[model samples]
Target: MTSLTSPTSGANRPARLGVQIAPQHAPYEKIRDTLTEVEALGADIAFNWDHFFPLSGDPDGLHFESWTMLAAWAEQTTTIQLGALVNCNSYRNADLQADMARTIDHISGGRFIFGTGAGWFERDYDEYGYEFGTPGSRLNALDDSLNRIEARWGKINPPPVHDIPVLIGGGGEKKTLRIVAQHADIWHSFGDPQVLEHKLGVLGEWCDKVGRDMSEIEISTELKTRTVEQADQLYDLGARLFTLGVSGPAYDLAPATDWLAWRDSKNA
Candidate 1:
């Protein structure tokens, strides 16, 4: 297992805001425009999810593919790092995923973060003709995929312009954290401060067992119904990258503007 500690990930790093523009319930132009807006608003990262169907609201709402849109986003925006908030590892071959990431990295001038995880959307699997295996099987596959992705990054031509950061999403303590200790430069979870503190402890245990420094992996979490003061509690627990998710049809960025203001204050 390779250590993918990012030069930019650490507790001391300035706090940054990420906006996940959900690719559902809207037209592609709206989604693209939202990405542009996020960048203009000073978001450090712009993200989308990798699901075939809507994760909320209308189950049959309009949606788009994750990677292709990311490729286009590479050309559409500059300066802001972008990627799927968490890509489904089972959707494509590991090597292919790595190659595509490298291409997007080049296209974005090295601003792509390879965010991925063991797939969990059963609807996606069932509807897209992918085998919806049990949780353990998907995790095992994710472990294998990470190893392949890292190896492929090494073999690919015109390799990623930078040591592409890998962001692994999920808070499963046993297998997921262990894999995170091995491969991730960033670990994202939806855990509140209390839960995040406990999970960080568990992740520390895994890091020790795997001989990886816990400080090497940056902590990330979502800002769902949490106040900035509440987010401060998470910051106290070592979360540096805070994400705010906005769904489409109307990707209102008012909250993102507020979050970005908070981020500016933190960094200041």
Candidate 2:
């Protein structure tokens, strides 16, 4: 992989802070409140997970569909960019996903990000009647879907207002990272610094093989702990989008605020 130290201007930089608000634990009003508060507090993005049932303990817990919730978030929050942390590629057809993203992009006045991934969560696929293939097969499907999504975007009547950033979440070194290098504008991975460093190396290697510049792909990770030092470490490793997840009705904003403050401090 190309080992350039600094990111290119106009796209890459020190990571921006964002928050993922789980829609399964809260009412619509609560979700809206959290989005508004996060955007007001200077979050660069607000995200929701895509799933029909709770991935946690109870399967029957309150949940909302991802695309629909994103449509609402698009209309509700004026400033913050909004998207699914990673929409499951198995859940929707490629053309349909492209159309949905395009619509939401316009709804947000060009503040929509198209975050997607190879489907996981066996329960989601089985319960939803989607084909739950092996990891490699799912990656193949994801790769195909991404191609279709791009092609469909070109064919759509009104193109997306902006070239909506595509965020792909996963750390599979072989296939997933290769896909990230080829397709993702942003790649989201979940792990500690050591792990992320290793994956970033692998991702870079994939970029090299594909003749893609690693610096062009933004690195993102979930912020399990809210600490300035941890954020700094991630920044040092070339991660430019730090994300923290909060499950609601409790809608805790402490971590989100802390990270946002750290982002502002860096920019300051």
- Evaluated with TM-score, which candidate comes out highest? 1
- Backbone clash numbers for all candidates listed: 0, 1
Q: What tens digits encode model 2's per-residue C-alpha lDDT throughout 3-64?
A: 33323231347558778888876778888888888888988999998888876655687788
TM-score of every prediction relative to native:
0.96, 0.93
- What's the lDDT for residue 233 in model 1? 78
RMSD of 1: 4.7
In candidate 2, stretches whose alpha carbon ends up further than 4 angstroms from where it belongs are 1-14
Q: What lDDT would each prediction earn against the true structure? A: 0.90, 0.85
Best by lDDT: 1
